[model samples]
Target chain A: MDIFRRNNVTVAGNPQGPTVVLAHGFGCDQNMWRLTVPALADAYRLVLFDYVGCGRSDLTAFSEERYASLEGYARDVVEVCEALDLRDATFVGHSVSSMVGVLAAETAPERIGSLVMVAPSPRYVDDEGYHGGFSAQDIDELLASLDSNYLGWSAAMAPVIMGHPDRPELGEELKNSFCATDPDMARVFARTTFLSDTRDDLGRVKVPTLVLECVQDVIAPREVGAFVHQAIPGSSLVTLDTTGHCPHLSAPEATNEAIRDFLAGLPR
Target chain B: MIHTDQQPEPYESQNEGAPDIQSHRDSTPDAAFAALLEDSAEELYEAAPCGYLSTLMDGTIAKINATLLDWLGLERDAVLGRMRFADLLTVGGKLYHETHFAPLLRMQGDISGIAMELRCANGDRMPVLVSSVVKYGESGEPLLIRTTLFDARDRRAYEEELLRGRKAAEEARRQAEADRARLQDALTVLQKSLLPDTLPTIPGVETAAHYHIASPDRLGGDFYDVFPLDGERFAFFLGDVCGKGPQAAAVTSLTRYTLRAAALHDADPASALATLNTVLHDRYTGSGDPRYCTAIFGILTPGASPGRLTIQLASGGHPPAVVLRADGTAAFLPTPGGLLVGVLPDAHFATAETVLTPGDTLLLYTDGLTEARTGADRTSLYGDEALLAFAADHAGKSTVDVIGALTDLLASFGDGLDDDTALLALGVPPLTAQP
Candidate 1:
């Protein structure tokens, strides 16, 4: 149960400087941070890792009962910190992983110095007083779409070039550079991410936090980000002019700059 | 090439700087045939079976085939420069396209067979299968995305049929699971009916019992009961039927009632077991899947003095009972030469007589306690010797204490306890019974 091997932990950049952990969302791995990592590479230590049952992390370590809720995912984050002996680290989480960071910070408050949530939604299903932009039936349809399309995704996205059998290292490079995930793991992760409700966990944050809301995101709307900001005390909120849920991929420069500005303003 | 005066000009080839090998270079038949082939290239592109289109890296449609434009019911000029490929998709499909498909295509260089529905110009929706590849330049930069679209009308109909079949199968499976759960609940209730809801409280004797079911899905044959026979005597029996399910449950009920009837008739443990053996042998002879049982029947009566009790216990091919004394001593009350009941016409049963003094406990359990598999190998059993040692270690314990410790021992076995266990313990208190 080595956490580094369990989560495919990768450490880069200035090791002596402040640590920034980048966590990917439901459908992707740590490679999603490729565009944003370089923006902070000169000033901070970059820590990247995939959750269990995603990317190159050990598939044998997955247990359905253990991952039925986001708390189990938070346990993984805490275990990673414990394994690396990281303290006062900044956590950058995208989509569902943002709530995962909130839960992790609640668990070990002294270990995390701050949090940055990008395009986050505390609840995806619509409730009585809140509009999360998705219905239960919509979520069910999304799960069905995943079921019908998983095989196609697996065969087409195996990270191996179609005509390059002679150079195996090229395939290895593609595997490391892209989001290569097992189909079954991806389905379970989608269920765990979209079906989770952790809005109550947001109010427990005592550290300095930043909420980055994309102006036109389909997955997490602007109001949801504003709700997160209002729930967590003394948290700063910034609205990005990006048009997609993935600002890191679609608008990396703006996303990175917003993060940099937020980090620079924090009292280290 | 025979290019007649009626044909329009050949459409321009999109590839730049290509050799004009298909043109009429010479007047030979080979050259003329090549020119003829070149003349129909635009015709093929316009009326091809599949729809083809090219888009810029930012998803703007740079070119499109005539077949795709015909399907959308739109003019050529309206779509050529006005729409992104994602704009053609439905709202949900567009979301999925942006979130998963676009990112994958950008990173992986190719993606295929993505299911999506396209919103046509006339406000009608059409289901389509799309496959796209990124064309790279000499410098390894992405130039354009070439996508081929297949009309999925027949395919969608077939998929709807398949979806209906799959949903039916899923409903049937869910129904079967719910049926299995309800049957398990009924069996559990029937099994519980055979045991006393609460052990009858004897003024001088303290009694406790525990039943360990290996699985809730199947009924276990283990049964135990403590019921009074008369003013001064109580009858108790603990046994295990050979198999599980309703048949074993029936046997368990028969054996329990038969033991009570025989004990009430003769008020002797040995004669009661003999009657049960005769009844079971008579009922199961010449039957399909013959059933049998191992039992230990006992009669309890208060002695002449307080804090004293005498018991006569009989075993029919069952494990011997254990006695943990008040002075920290433990031993098994051996009942030897007992044959399995309902197996033979003249099966023998043996009786053991023991006294329960102050602070002494007597334990009766089925073979599940001794024959439980131990450790990871699953072949080594927690044998009778281990049970004897366990009894010795927990000596001078009350009835509840003994039962609780045995329950913990059963739990420690985890998945190794493959059979159900029945435990009954009776003790005489050192002090006043309720003080």
Candidate 2:
């Protein structure tokens, strides 16, 4: 199987420059970084791809036995790096993909130079001594919300609340687009994303890492970002004033600048 | 103009000289109508069935109806500019609002029928169903979120009852699964009891046996045993009962006990099978359910000459026993024209006599081996020809070697082996063993 075709890998920017891979979170595809890509495209070679079962990736390649955990997704990340012939790459991951980057960097440390985790939560469900910000019942409600509002919610509300007042077409394009995957696959992906616990894998990260916490993010709260930063050795934490789960989409300027500063400060 | 027309009494009071008609009374229609309109609008806003509110995009409360304030037990002044909608909910509800509700509203524009619990001024929780829509400005930018909430006391109570019922059902399902596993365990123990714990060793013969269970959940009806009948002689039997489960197990136990007793009594394989056939036919003849089996009974005796063993075998509708010679050749020991045992009052069983020389083996197996599917498509069976070829390929091997090859073959079948099978191989030691 062709790894690029399996993951729908797309390459842009400086061909000879060091690679910067942008991995999107759950409920979204590669297009989620549409707002932040242009900022880093000039100086860095960008590699963007959708996880299998998202975007234009081959859906037939999905196997239950192969993708039983986030490690399977990390394997896809490693394969994407190998397919693109990239080295010492910077991995920028959002939401669930943040933990995915951690796993991928651990898998092939030589391939990844640094990691930028935006609004990352290593776990979502609450534990004995930790507050992952959600109870089991809350996750159930979220799944039910997905069930009730699959495509209908997008058509009904896309124009009003999506931040792009100047370009409503962006919202319209997202209606049954972007994260428009098979509903069954989406449900499985959601389960795999939220039910995962990867806090133990953070210590294995050898690459320099950045933890970006948004001011009012409901998904990954301040404490979660702090916990991630404390877990990864020598990782820097940047708290953005952005007020939503999606910092790149809601506040692309601050998100891109923070990433830029971190990449520049790296010992290249 | 209507007020001026209806102001006859006031006009009369002003002009006291005018006529005072009986129907001409004083009236203040303008003031009364103005007061009524003002009272109704305020009343409707204060006491509507559903609560209504509008909040800024960041969730700070701007305007709220009196009905909502009353439900929360909070004064209008205290809630107006102070708290966001998410702040009013319980912790779990707050998390849900932030993760699912807020993101969904931002991307889609409206959310409805969401279940949440709002905190009251008294620190009590109130269950409510909420629906909200994002209002847009002329430029399509979000202006404010208009929301409607309904008191869901009855719905909550009903759902709680439903939840209790669902929990009970789930408990019942788990209990049923546990009970089923216990039954399967019991069945496995019962099935093991019918087979030999260990094959009894003869002075110069080696033996090995294997049983393949298609499923552990159900009891298989195959049985094999080797035991001493009398001095210098031993009896052995392997058979497949007609069906599975408790009834077939009963017949298998009865057949095994009867064969051992009959062989010990007469020292002949043919007589032993005859006794089993008679007992089974009599037991199930008048009963609605009839049990039957295909079986082979054998009696082995050390040869009066050296480097050999004498065997007398009887078959009742069973596959012919196979023999592998020391000279690297294999052939079937023919026991033809036999009928299935326990099916008839006088069913005839055939007897065959053979000798096992040094390094020769005699193998007996059930139909499951030959009938197992042999291909990925499951269209081809590991038929009698394949079994014969397998025996020929390992003709000069010992009992353990033959059983090992058969074990590999069975595993290679994988899910294709859909039936329970039993294999028994008895071999004489090589001639040079006693040197």
Candidate 3:
């Protein structure tokens, strides 16, 4: 199989500079990095891709049994790295992808050298002593909400979502195509994202890690951010003063500056 | 009543133009009513039927209409400048708004017809459809956001009903497929029971048999068996019952057991077939659904001389058996005068006898082989002449080789071979020199 085409991998930016792979989280595809790409393109070699079952990636390659856990997504990441023969590259993941990057790093230690977790959370449901800011019932309600919005992702809404006749410069492939996904695949992805627990894997991070959290993210609260920081002994944490879960889109300037500084500090 | 009250006014003012009546009404109660009909734009904004709101780029509500405030049961003071649009949604709706709704709106200038639920003041959920647009400033920068909400209670309930109906239909289709698979499995097990798992090894002879079924869904009526009749003799039979399905299968099962029992009582081939004929005619002749079958029964007895065997066989409305000689020649042992068994009280069974020298074989089969269709148009039958020629081609070969070649010939017919076929071959092994 052509791994690059299967994952819809895209390579951009300075070819001679260090590589940085941008991995988007659930509910969106590689387009989530649209705003952040421009800020880092001048100094880094950027790799962006949509996981299987998301964006324009091949839907036929998606297997429910394989993707039911986080390992399947990590395998996609590792394969992309091997396809390009990347070495010592930095992996930047958002939301649930932060844990996926950690797993990829563990599987192929040579391909990914450092990590940058954006709005990261190892767990979303609350435990007895730890507060991840959600109850088990809340995740179920989220799945229900995904079911209710099935019409938005259906073919009836495709023409409206893909129609951008006024913006002819956006090209045929990129015209207004933003978070359109198959409803059934999205349901599987949603279940995998909200139900997974990767808190135990945080202690094994052996690379240079940067944990970027938003100031008022309801999905990943400040307490969860602190737990992630303390779990990784030498990891650094930076909190962006934003209101939503996506700091890169909400506060792009601060998010870019933090990422650039972390990359510069890494060993050559 | 109003028409009757004003009926005489137009006629009384015919001398004047229509404008004179309009001017005269300026001084009457009609003028006051017209004044009341015209309202300012402010009243329309506050009293529209649907909910409306405008927010900043970051979702801070800057303005809200009275209709939306009434739906939320909140005062204007409590909402404006104090809440974002995400605050009014339930937890699921809030997550949806943050993940899918917000990203989509930012990418496209506007988004419409999104279904969601809002939390009212008393904790009741209200289903609504929302549409939003981003207003751009003079510098092409995004400014405030404008939104409208429509109550979708009735529509949501109907959609739920459709989803339920679709689920039920899918479940029923799955159940039907499972039932068909289970029934096919049962039919396969029952079909296996009608034949021997393996033929017994005769002391001084070699035997090979093959049975072919045209369709797995329907049980075929073809059957064959080879078993010992006594210490010095072996009995074999091959047949096809008339028609197909359960009734034919019942007849096939009965015929096999009756022939076996009669052959044990008397090793003569003709007597064994006559007893089977009597049993079948007595059991089925008087019934309205009379049944019958075509069969060839035979016995093999070792001759007094070494490297030789005696064969005695009888046929009841069955095709002739072929004999292949050691000198590479083949001929049919015809039994032409036989009547179909179970058709009459006293049926005439034709009898034939032959000697099998070393390297000689006897082949018996059902009509499914000779009646198979051939040619490009599939209109020609593979008759006795072609089978005799085929046997001639494989003369002097062992029983296994001859049977294997015939099995290949049957397979070559493909869809043209529609009926069940059974083949049984018995041969005396070729003599080998002493070491």
Cα-based lDDT for every prediction = 0.81, 0.81, 0.84
Off by over 4 Å in 1: A1-11, A21-27, A47-247, A250-268, B1-44, B137-139, B159-218, B226-232, B240-243, B261-266, B270-296, B301-435
Best candidate per DockQ, number? 3
Candidate with the larger DockQ of 2 and 3: 3
Per-residue C-alpha lDDT of model 1 across residues B1-435, encoded as one tens digit per residue: 011122221255533212464344454467667765564566677888888888877677888889999888878888887887877776656656755777677666777777777778888878788888887765666667778889987887777677678668879999999999899889878879888899999988989999998888777899888889899999999999999878888999999899888988997887888899899988998886677899999999899998889999899998999998877778999999888888888888989999998889999999888999997889899998889889988877778988999999999998889899999999997663458
lDDT of 2 at B264: 76
Candidate 3 segments whose C-alpha is farther than 4 A from its true place: A1-19, A34-63, A75-88, A151-185, A248-261, B1-49, B136-141, B197-212, B227-235, B242-291, B300-312, B319-333, B337-346, B353-414, B417-435
Off by over 4 Å in 2: A1-88, A91-239, A244-246, B1-49, B135-141, B160-193, B196-217, B226-234, B240-243, B257-266, B270-294, B302-309, B314-435
Q: Model 3: what is its DockQ?
A: 0.49
TM-score of chain B of each: 0.78, 0.74, 0.77
Ranking by TM-score: 3, 1, 2
- In candidate 3, position B24 carries an lDDT of 55
Worst 10 residues of 2 chain B by lDDT: B1-10
| CAPRI docking class of candidate 3 | acceptable
Evaluated with lDDT, which candidate comes out highest? 3
RMSD of 2: 12.1
DockQ, 0 to 1 scale, candidate 1: 0.16
